[model samples]
Target: MAEWGSAWSTTPSVGSRVVVTGAAGGLGRELTSVLAGLDVTVAGIDRPGTTGTSGVPLIEADLTDDAAARHAVEEAADLLGGIDALVGGAGIVDTIHRADTFPLAAFRADVEANLLAQFVVAQAAYPALKAAGTSSLVFLSSIAAQDGLPGQASYAAAKAGVLGLTRSLAAEWVSDGIRVNAVAPGLFATPKVLAMPASARDRLLASVPLKRVATLGEVVGSVLYLLSPAAGYTTGQILRLDGGAGLTLGGFYR
Candidate 1:
């Protein structure tokens, strides 16, 4: 085996073309801004009323709709000359509800936003990714999938589906030179998260082995690494950025 030296870069190639979904959201907007500053051309797809970020082309579309998602991705590809990477960040976590009483419609909505939408966007970007001869697709999952947070049945189920989808796509698209992976983030210090009541934040922090929440930069760093040449040989893997929180979960003895 080769020695662990700087054989490759952990950053996206300068001038690389990237597409981001859910660009209007906090994480998506942050990611788009970071990519734009990295010399990579970026285009974002979000809901129709989202305000466009400066320096990033934002295309409004209903990502859960197959036709609309495909059209938006194709338009982004056309504008960028082709696509080198795609970040499927569009998803929704509905208000917490008990599984027994969770509306079927709400469950479907979560599955549609978190699972089906990701698949559709990936399908739409396949041609461009294949044409690039080497590309990366990163999906956002959640630690809830593993820890099974209470009142998050639908969100957890949808995120678990994302894991399955990531692996399947990685296997099917390996020959096409497309790499697929996912990032499962735990409680991160986003605006909304940081604004939580002190007691709530403390409760969350107590569960994390690190005794703290992850920074948005750290989560973004994971995505960036997976999309760069350094992770070229890595695919179908889920990188859990939960600060060892997964270890705190109880395990079945049987």
Candidate 2:
């Protein structure tokens, strides 16, 4: 890992402010910890019942609510005196049913939680990101978005939307010095993946060339690269950290 100062000639200082949504969750917590290790001031937002970790300030907000999203951004900005990066790590996966048998309510809820929440956060943070000039915005997508898994229609659609959002915003904000990008992770050893049935878990692992799930730290590393000056010229792209699962299409189809 390169020192923060040497990573980007124009990158913000280590103590710069970063806001992460879904902070209490598996991936979110790992991201928060990594940012904190870099000496960045982090403000995490999750729903009620999810509290801060490691003494980092955690704000309770259902990001699906536009007003609450805006308020969280405002409060975080005020606390940090400014915002340098906005990492939208909150998303939901409805794995209970196939598309044909999936409940409409469940689908709608997944869309709201995964897709709309990201939109709300990005919209609310646009001003702060623009003000920061060289700020970065990262969205957590999934391999399901591109692979279109059997029972993940809602999650796939929502994460696919995130890819579109990242590209469009990266184009729209280049002039403002804000970079927008996304990470598409394959099966990782997160709380969600750990909860899958044994058979389903084995099948998921078999699809990957590595035959093993990723760690939260590996996923966070890719995110940090995108947000850092190392990827200063990289934006409007989706970094797939799936252990080559996307390349094993024949196995998945078999």
Candidate 3:
């Protein structure tokens, strides 16, 4: 423990080589900015036509496509001289839907975006991370995955897959000196979440122990911890950053 602390003291947050997928999205963009401020080298990948903040080497590609995702991962590894960390921030959410009425096509699309895309990126980044020898991977999950929230069946299922992915990968990759985990965050102030009707939002907020939405800084801090050596001994875990909504879950019905 002391040895890791000493190492962290010297390396700091700077000099880390990281790749962030879904880089143009709300959470991704915020994480990228924070990484930049830390002086870490970052390669960002997202769908075409989305612009990431300046200073990162942005690679635009449809990550739902396995081949394109692999290419982007390899390219990001090359650009970073190897990857010390990867943040699988790509996701899709279906709000206000009834499971019985949800179309199979829509359900499949959500799975592809929220679950399979993360798998694609994670698998593609494994070789690069293994080569790095002491790397970390963080997957994005949601509080929806934990409880049976109404109108969130498809999204919940996909995010639940992420939790399973996190645990499995953490076990499989530990021998390679790689750490894997996930953050099952509650409602954050992202565009999608903020767009919920006020009454609906209020209902959700009242259920939160924190009584407010999570800020970008809070989520980013959790990500930084998992990626840094400070959490070196942590793996196969889900950091439930949900403000205790998991403790009591009835108010957030959507």
Q: Compare the candidates by lDDT and give the number of the best one.
A: 1
What RMSD value applies to candidate 3?
2.2
Candidate 3 structure quality by residue, lDDT tens digits, 1-254: 87656556422256889999988988899999988888689989999899997888899888889899899899999888999999999876755579989888888888898999999999999998899888999999987787756777889899999999999999999999989999888888898778899988887788787888999889988888888877878899999887777777363443
Number of the top candidate by TM-score? Answer: 1
lDDT of 2 by residue, 1-254 (tens): 46665766433357779999989998888888777777678889888788667968999988878898889889998988888999999877745687789988888899899988998999888898899879899999987777776777888898888999899999999899998999988878877678899998887678778888899878888888887778888889999887877787553323
Ordered by lDDT, highest first, the candidates read 1, 3, 2
**Candidate 1, 204-246: lDDT as tens digits:** 7776778888888898889999988889899999999987776
Q: Name the candidate, 1 or 2, with the larger TM-score value.
A: 1
Q: Which residue window of length 10 is worst by lDDT in model 3? A: 4-13
Reference-based lDDT, each prediction: 0.88, 0.84, 0.86
What is the lDDT, from 0 to 100, of the residue 61 in candidate 1?
98
Off by over 4 Å in 1: 1-7, 251-254
Q: For each candidate, give its TM-score against the true structure.
A: 0.94, 0.91, 0.93
